[model samples]
Target chain A: MHNRNAWAIAPLMALSLAACSGEADKSADGAPPAPTNQTLAEVIADKGEMDTLEGVIRNAGLSDVLAGKGPYTVFAPADAALGAAGSDLSDEAMKAQGAALLRAHIVPGALTRADILAALERGGTGGVQMRTMADGLLTFSRDGDAVTVTAADGATARLTGDETVAANGVVQPVDGLLVKAE
Target chain B: MKRLIPLTSVLVLALCASSPALAQNGNGNGHGKGHGAGNPVQQDRDDDGDDDRREGRRNGNGRENRAERDVPRNHRSAEVRVREIVGDPPREGERAVRELRRGLERGESVVGREVIGPRRDEVRALLQGCPPGLAKKDNGCLPPGQARKIDRSQSYDRYNYLWRSFGGDGGYQYRDGYLYRTAPDGGLLGYLPVLGGILSTGNVWPTQYTYQQPPQYYSRYYGLNDRYQYRYSDGVLYGVDPKTQAIAQVAALLTGQQIDVGQRMPAGYDVYNIPYDYRDQYVDSADRHYRYSDGYVYQVDPTTRLVQAVIQLLT
Candidate 1:
């Protein structure tokens, strides 16, 4: 009687284990995964070259939006670019640049590097006139291997290195300080 | 023992009654002889003491009343001094001068008391000497035909003299050939030339007269409506209107997303970022996926991705 009872209990335990494994597999296959598009915050965290720009971003109090889930085209300047332009990278200078200079760097939509370059080539004015987040127009000039950007106030800046893709936006490194005309 | 107690009680009552009477009499004469007999010298002394106390009280009341009356006068004098220091009286004086000017402009005689009595003859002579046949209207003085010609010739010879004495610019010619000067109101100051003829009423030649025109409107650069250009220097943004070249310093205290120089920013485009490479172009590419020519950073629009910040930089 004892031997018969053990045999019956062993089969029931095996069936229960099998049912648990099947439920686990179904659950794994049930829902879709998270999206692959990185947010602006994710992009900044991933790209390591935006330390100086990051400081400015914080001082200008733009961390929250840049870190949010949107496709933004950020014309990011490197430490060297700011140095070349003779901008004292001081907290005071960053504060002085304020929102106006920052607005000049951003566009409304996410523009890929290829799309921007292609736009510059097609615009035919030797550059493409892109309205900035500041309502000011930024003109893009292509020279051989490098690109030059002129602000509405006639301030010119050069892109030194390459484009960086963040989860939320794209950051293009620049080599000079672009100031608004007074 | 009971009888002794009653005797003591009676003695105590007598003593209490006697004490008050002695105190009342002590302030009066020291006499209790017979009915009202007292020391005459002591009575005179008491009377004199009472009189002195009454006199002191009267004097004190008079002093207090005098002080109370003087307080308002002192306050009034202080107020007058403050008004004088603040030049309120001078402003009033200017108002009086304006009234006089208005009266003169209307060709009306001004009547006011002088330091001495009014000199009616002097005033009449001054009025009679005014050039004959000239328009006596406000800011209107024109010389007659012959006198105008003579003055013109003389003005050419003595331009500086006419400019100093008659306040005339000989070079300036009005449409009516009236030699007008620059008035304080920025309008034409007209003057009439004096002829060698005495007025019919008096033998006085009108000379050294000044004409004042009404105030005119002048439009300055501040009145224009144009976009203001801005430049950043020493951490401050300065607004410069390209059309007028008017410069205004932007206030440092600002918050929002837009870059406005003199005007307040609108609602939606309030988030801002500092511009990178403002004047020149920059090339940037990384990770082999993206590339661009101009590396101008901007504050991107959150909803529509539109860039709506102030174009502070102008060519």
Candidate 2:
């Protein structure tokens, strides 16, 4: 599918889900800004260190989706996250692989740390199944205060700190990449 | 009058005896549900047994034999030749073969996915009506525009009989050690016999060439925390200062020699624990590349190495 069309549908799905959950707060236009703080994009932007992810979002042309009124759960990776990736992507490769990689980190619901912890508590042996924007499942396992996120490809990332409260969603810093399953 | 009375009595006695016999037989033909000519219970059991056997055959027992027999000897021989050359093919390399076979069976042109060599039309014609004993040589079977030979002396190490198509889309790739045909769009056609090239001395093709690197200077920061670590692209490492979150590039931190860009790290170090968010972003190289990600800087795995995310490396 064309990248533009894929991204266009993602936001709509997220927005519709948000509306269903009573998460969308309307002002003038049908698309209303989040009631709380900045959007997921703004939260990342506010952090000067996350330039790589911001560049990916910009390069992949997904700035609007992240900035839109979405109840997204973004597992924001740290700058080291990109460096920790074994090799570097070319400009062309960044454009090609960035959106899919970024989408894998963003889930549909604005699930906060507490919400995740609560779900994990109720889930027992089975971890919480958070569906990513790319339509893959991220298994979240909680151990006391720390939360470990397992990607589809079996790579694991730890939630580094407290979840950031964004206007339309929640942002949690992950130590690793949430690689999509092939 | 006495004689008539006796005859009537005899007829009544015969009727009573026949009535009792008919009632015992139920259907009156001496054939009932359990005692019928056709046993429904036994028939059902036989049908179920046949179904089970059919299911078993479908599940690889019987079908496997048939599949082995059905494979064209030439194609099977090509795979055998490949195995002989490679000794044992890796999983990924085997996948390449499977891809080639599927494309050929479906009559699809594999023009773009690295199997570039011949036009789809040419390949279809050759495969559809492949002559018996179509040995590895480029028989004049292909029309003039179908295949044109190219010298692979400089770039390719193994194969000498390299042939590409006229339209610049597809052709045949015959490595001295490897054997396969490519469609016009670079899709794999299928494995072919040792097409007039010396079988490789041994499988020397690099096992680890799968890692793909992400863009340079790309970094994402989660938040300011005590756990944050820092590094310069030049191989320096620093711990994030707790109070200020400031980091400095310390060259002394690198224990071994400085690794050049594109140079794979020599195997010795242990695998650094990689975080998840960056797993999908690494680049793969033929050789190992030095990478610093997660907390510790490390080497990318020789096989399945992605420059973006950490696989396994020397400690």
Candidate 3:
């Protein structure tokens, strides 16, 4: 009777140990588990900065596109960058320029922050030009810790702060307007 | 002396003969009250005078009524009507005269009201009937010529309106008689001008284009006060001042996001507080995918960077 009881407890202990080890393995893998079908709005909601980006997004006229099935990389401009653009950035003006700039910042495919940083680090003579969802080209450059982007029209804007990784793509805050080439 | 006496007697006889008929009509006889009791000729003369007086009063009253309607009650100036018609060669002048005459026949009051209180349809009709030269002009009116020239000029105004509406220089270049905006990206965030183009198609009514900016109460959560509030739609953002709640409502229609009131929103979403200010900040979390703050909720795209969805939180 005692031998039989020991055998039953042994199996239970072994199963528990295996479960612990599996959890440990998952933690060791630094990647965050994949999030399902989360929208850009949902992601921003988590950060508590949706209001700041909302105006810029609306001005860019990309609300629908961003809400759509987009694995889009958005080079979002912070409120400070937007303020620095001056009072002339009226609603009408933003509406006029928002779509193009938003398109310029976005790439249709998912690009992790790691990928962008790596691309910037591997700088070549030609620099890296990523095709935007708008069919325009966005050029990337790196100066030590700072990443600079020269839009299609040679308008240079600097990327600021840490790169945020979302399920669909990456978000890097930018300072200044991204002009599209004619 | 005998001849003078005979002339006086003839005059007296004539006066005596007409006196009875005049008295019968003038006395307001009870018989006259029933239509044909009085002589028809005398009644007809009196009726003609009364009709003339009534016609004069009507014309005067019409002008007064039109002036009151055209010029607002607070505005003191009398509104005047001015219609210029553009025609080709000698016929152009004739057409202009004819239109002016027609306008006159329509009554000055009507013309004045049409000019002062212009409607979208009226403007459209005017543009459609514009002469070649007078269709579009920088300061005054365009001169009449080929229909193409008039059409080009009219279209130019539409483009100018689009540019001005989007906060761009109203000047548009005409290349080979085609109007185009020179900016490569074209206006504000590259959305306004394109929107203007779409609007110019005239499929939608002008009254339907009532997009306002977002309100200040919602800006507190995002740390944006009056400076940055704007609306986004159709892949473009519009920058408007004095952001109103209506903007958020319109944005919801454009973006397919639900902006409900009184809901506990996610950390980054917009929230409205009474007595609006710019300093309101709330704890941001990655779990809550939507939030309502500053009279609008920040709609998030869960698939992108945690902050990428912030763009949709706009006015």
On TM-score, the candidate that comes out on top is 3
Model 1 B-chain TM: 0.15
TM-score of each: 0.29, 0.32, 0.34
After superposition, the stretches of candidate 3 with alpha carbons farther than 4 Å from their true spots are: A1-37, A44-50, A59-61, A84-94, A120-125, A180-182, B1-135, B139-179, B182-315
lDDT of 2 by residue, B1-315 (tens): 111011122211121121110000000111112211232211111112221221111122222333334433332211100000111221332243343334323433111110011122322232222222333345222223444334432233121222221113345444322334556565555442221121111212111111011111111121112343332111112233334433321111111122221234432221221222222222223443333322223334345331111111111
How much native contact recovery, as a fraction, does model 3 achieve?
Answer: 0.02
Two-chain DockQ for each candidate model: 0.01, 0.01, 0.03
Top-DockQ structure, candidate number:
3
C-alpha displacement of A108 in model 2, angstroms? 0.2
Worst 10 residues of 1 chain B by lDDT: B78-87
Model 3 DockQ, alpha carbons vs. true complex: 0.03
Per-residue lDDT tens digits of candidate 1, residues B182-265?
A: 355544444332111121012221223211110000001112123543322211223345455333323111111222111222
- Ranking according to DockQ, highest score first: 3, 2, 1
Q: Local error of candidate 3 at B122, Å? A: 34
lDDT (Cα atoms) of all candidates against the true structure: 0.34, 0.37, 0.34
Report residue B278 deviation for candidate 3 (angstroms): 42
Better of 2 and 3 by lDDT: 2
List ranges where model 2 is wrong by over 4 Å: A1-35, A84-92, A180-182, B1-315
